[model samples]
Target: MNLPEILADLQLILEEYQSRLDHYSDQVFMLSPEIGCWSMAEVYSHVFGTCLMQQKAMEMCMQGQGMEGSAGLNEMGDKLFALGHFPPGKYEAPEALKSRVQNIHKEDAKALATKLLSRIKSVQSEDILNANEDQRMEHPRLGFLNASQWVHFMLIHTKHHLNQLDRIERKFSMC
Candidate 1:
């Protein structure tokens, strides 16, 4: 999607998150609803943390600080871009990343979301829009992605997590 479209979608998703936050009681925000599941706060923490990392990669690529002569997006990246979303499945966080989302308070999650939305809005320069595809960062699984792709990935990633948020809310309501 184009920058404007991406920005609009991102804003909508962030607003949705904020709306949920507005309605959640402290107990509901912190409840997991089941074993081995993330609380709503943890989910927000994880999404914002990942988006921040992706945003940094996009900035690096736009500034020509990405890996020189890097091979572009791999097959999976191509598929994901073509699909415009992640394929349906459960994805596990790496062991190192698991702890980062733990015990996140609602206020901390709100702060992270605010910071991320601000950073995302700041990347609308012409340089970023026309960033050189060769200046790319390696996604741990999706291979090298340039600035534009990184932006798109952030959108897809956030949208993908909305389902998780819905599920958590549903489970909480049932309890």
Candidate 2:
């Protein structure tokens, strides 16, 4: 897909996520009926964390001469997901998410999205298609992803969390 399409989808996903947060944040964090599931607060935190990590990847890809070459992100991600989450994919439960990690997490998510948008806007077409394969970046969890996979992973991961965000909206939303 082209940049326009990729960006368009990202915008739509962000809108969906924002709407969910706006509708539910005021109520209380957890999936409603107070089921004590993953809180809206926690979901927000996770999405935010993931987005920040993604935005940070560009820098790592560009600068971190560490071991996280192209396939690094996937390998690390698969392992992390395998350890903590249930598949097909589900956000970790709030108790599972951390007690002290509320407001800070939410803020982190916002910062990540904001930064990601800034960096993404600066990406030239050539940069996207022409990044070196063996060129590597050391991410916090997933090590590195070649340029193409990183782009794909970034979009794919955003959509995945958007789905999670949607679920949180449905379960906890007042509407």
Candidate 3:
């Protein structure tokens, strides 16, 4: 997607997430739908935190700090962008990163979501728009992506989690 489209979608998804924060009671937010699954709070925390990290990567690219090379997206990255979303299935974070996912408070989650939205908005500046398209950062699973691709990935990632959120809510209602 183009920058404007990416920004609009990002804004909508982030606002949707922020609006739903109040819908969850503390118990529901912290409740895991099943054993070995993340609670809604953990999901929110992970999504927002990962988006922020992606934003920083974008910023680094804008500042010309990205790796200088003709490195292109790996096969997985090409497929992901072509599909414009994650494939259906469960994905596990690396073992080291798994511990970073925590049961966050609803208020804290809301604040992080807000910050991510703000960061997305800030990326519309001239510098970010003019960032070196050839410069790239490597994502462990997805391969190297430039600034615009990073923004697109952020949108895809958040939308992917909406389904997970729905499943969690449904499980909560069933209990």
Candidate 4:
């Protein structure tokens, strides 16, 4: 997609996430409402952390040091944008992030998410846009991706979690 289209979709997804958050009361947002279920706060925190990591990866690519030159890796990146997400139950968070996931306060989640959204917006700038498309970085599971693919992955990743948030909202009757 072109820059405007990408930016619009990114903005749309971020707005949708914020709107979902708006529907939940503070108490409701904090409730898991089921065993092994994550609270809305934890969900937001996870998304925020993932976006932060993506941002760092983009920065690394700009520095000419993160590219791993994985063969056939662009196809993996294409599949992510095409499929929208990893198949449910088919992927797991790394052990380090597992413990970091927790029930953050509502305000804190909003702040983190807002900051991430802002970074998403910043990617439209010329310098970021012109970053080496040939540069690649290795993902733990999805394999190698270039700078634009990283941003696209952020969009696909947010979209994947939006569905989970919808179900959680319904489970708690917040939707």
Query: Which candidate leads the pack in TM-score?
Result: 3
Alpha-carbon RMSD, each predicted model: 1.8, 5.3, 1.8, 2.5
Query: Using lDDT as the measure, what is the rank order of every candidate, best first?
Result: 3, 1, 4, 2
Report the lDDT tens digits of candidate 4 across residue range 1-175.
7556766787789877776777678988888879888888888888888778887887777666676555535565567667767767634577777678879888887888788788777665455577776677777666777776777777777877888888887887765
Judging by lDDT, tell me the better candidate of 3 and 4: 3
Q: Rank the candidates by TM-score, best first.
A: 3, 1, 4, 2
- In candidate 2, stretches whose alpha carbon ends up further than 4 angstroms from where it belongs are 2-4, 29-36, 63-112, 138-143, 173-175
RMSD of 2: 5.3
Q: TM-scores across all candidates?
A: 0.92, 0.64, 0.94, 0.84
lDDT of each: 0.83, 0.56, 0.85, 0.75
Clashes of 4: 0
- Native-to-model Cα distance after best TM-score fit, residue 56 in candidate 4, in Å: 1.7
> How many residue pairs collide in each prediction?
0, 3, 0, 0
Give, for candidate 3, the lowest lDDT window spanning 10 residues.
Answer: 120-129
Per-residue lDDT of 38-91 in model 2, one digit per residue for the tens?
A: 566666666565555555665455554434434555665666434433246454
lDDT for position 84 in model 2: 34
Clash pairs, candidate 3, are none
